[model samples]
Target: MNAPEPSAPGVRPEQEALFSTTAEHYARFRPGLPGPAVQLLAGTLAGRRAPVLLDLGTGTGQVPQALLAAVPRLAHVEAVDVNRAMLVQSRSVLGPLLGGRTLRLVHGSAHSYTAASGTDSVAPDLVTCCRSFHWMDRPAVLAMADRVAAPDATVAIMGDGSLWTHRAGWTRQLRELIQRHLGTARRAGPADAYTAPVRSYEEDLAASPWSDVAEHRCPVPRTWTPQGVVGYLRTTSFANAGLFPDSRHHDVFERDALTLLTALAEEDGPLVEQAEFRVLLARRPGGAR
Candidate 1:
């Protein structure tokens, strides 16, 4: 997911800064949307001869990487992100996936992305935001999509719970350790606190141009190594490097977390999570693809 653009108002500063320092870890450790989720996103562009994708908060190009492989008619992708480092990382990771197709990386928040987003001329067939919609100014972003999206375009708001939100014995213990270091309140940014959105994504879309919606859920089982678990935490809002008081605090937290995860992995066999990857397929009520 992409962060906040320093200029875009109405979004939290913490949202923009969540994955800033851990760009590399995010590019490496954050898992892509499963096969079923990608296929559902692809299905939206069913009849378009050459579909263009506008991936808002295109962190490390995960949405495009999955969709490009699943939808061959997808010829161009204009990926926007708030972090330059993430865009740099995205370029490298998405390079191999583009078989002579176009993948343009735009540095801006989803709330900030527009038709004149530098070289981005994306009147996209399908607009996607994977693991990223929560970080946006939802109404503003939908309005932007309304202006820029092609006729009959589909907007897919997709995400899954993070390791911090997962339910499991190891996850419970891991949360406790994180709380011990960062406090009980989940940290969303440096010096900034976390809070729930005033409206759900569904409610936000209901009041926007994309009023009609359908949701799809894919249950995915995942296993993680102790090291993999640590890396994923390094990219999360509650436990990234930014939340620590100092380098020593971050280091100690990592050490303690690894120790905890290793023991759990040994005794429980695997550090596992049953994640529900969800896609909210929204389109304007009267529009038909």
Candidate 2:
């Protein structure tokens, strides 16, 4: 299937496929959800004997990799991604990790993901959308979750702020440098500028069937090397190579950004990102479990 056309509240029509071409960079350098956040997500499955997971926007299979590592007893996972390349990367990353457990990949939008069957045994005990909710039609996906999620299943919407949203002296400098190359508006894909979502994730949750909710915050301290920073940027929508007019333009930008980052790292010691993983745990009105 072709990639999902961007029409979600978090993603406008312009930011198509989001990270369609950066699968390798995403698998390698994308600082996935924090360990504490993954642990918290894992903790939600303790009530189930052999928990099954339905992870939306399972980019590069980070959430599953982290969850499976944390919970060895995870029975099965249904990972969905609109970008087939991401799913391909997911297969490689998760293949070695799954010790004979089941992993089914759905190549479509999250809202379009349905279980292979309607049996309770196949319904997911835990449903997670991490770091990718902004790229989805929130209401539609949650509605779909209501249909497929187990009666007592927990629906978690989670993510953290990125370096583009970070406010630090050096990060601001880096953002400025990126703007110089890509322009003032934060580039979404090769064609469009990004717009902040009109509604908050909490608002979307409150309006959906999964209205009963709890918010969790995990403070994560991260240190990045100059090269690590560059690799990570390669995966970002704001500064990816596609946003540049040409490969040569991108190369120059990366070169200049690295020089600035190296200098900043040396002067400031360690380049740190004080990121917080936030999750909205939503359930039915009377609660599932």
Candidate 3:
């Protein structure tokens, strides 16, 4: 049977399939949350004895992995994602750290996932969606967070823009090369094309129940080699290897992309990708600003 089509605009059905097959590449090449970002998350739960966290769309469990490494007192984490393949990769990545603490891998989307209801159940002190909120129904997810979160809980929507959107000299040249090989239009899945987001994340958050929002910007410096850029591109929706019609097509694109990146890097030491990591914190009304 075929997969169901994505109902929402700006969501491509191919995303689910692409991520499922590229989980290994994602886990290997995707960057983790910066130290300051993790520290900010930890600071929010400073007074709690044993903080519990809910990571929505927790791809390969990167957010949880970083949090567990930084915040030793965190007692439990519920890593939720619709893709089971990503959860499998997450299990492998988080294997060593699961000794004393609890790491529950729940296979579900952000909007539908419910916390355990009994008195023994812990309310999440922090709910984080990193680089995955754009794919979700923001209002619905915020409503779910309102229902499941502790009174003082924080909902952090974090992302650094993708490789396709980055604006650097080398990145611009690389994009043009991709367009020349593929086409002028952006590709999503196999035949689907990419569409720009209609609404800003801030606009969606302000309309939700958790409307007390604050923004944090962290400059994360990254140096990417030609091979590293190619690896990362494979993990993105616009440039996933699976999107190509044939192996030959994918090989051609990869060869050209690498050659272009290498030529650009020859002028400089390595390609310095432009990235400003952003975290938008939304809290319940009347909570800390």
Candidate 2 residue-wise lDDT, 1-289, digit = tens: 1132333233323434567658888888987777778878888888678889999989888999999899989989988877767878888888888886878877777887766654445889889998889877888999999998888889999888799998788889999999888889998888778878899988998999888899989988889888998899988888887777788988999899999999999888888888888988889889755
Spell out the clash pairs found in candidate 2.
Answer: none
- Order of all candidates by TM-score, from best down to worst? 1, 2, 3
Residue ranges of candidate 2 with Cα displaced over 4 Å: 1-17, 117-121
lDDT of 1 by residue, 92-114 (tens): 88788888787767777787776
On a 0 to 100 scale, what is the lDDT of residue 281 in model 2?
A: 87
| Candidate 1 error regions (>4 Å) | 1-16, 117-122
Model 1's lDDT to the true fold? 0.84
Which candidate leads in lDDT? 1
Note the residue pairs that clash in candidate 1: 4-16
Q: Which lDDT tens digits does candidate 3 get at residues 6-103? A: 22233334545757556889877888888888888888888889999999988898898998888888999888877767888888888787668877
Query: Using Cα atoms with residue i matched to residue i, what is each candidate's TM-score against the true structure?
Result: 0.92, 0.91, 0.91
Model 3 C-alpha lDDT versus the unseen true structure: 0.81
Q: How well does candidate 1 match the true structure in TM-score terms?
A: 0.92
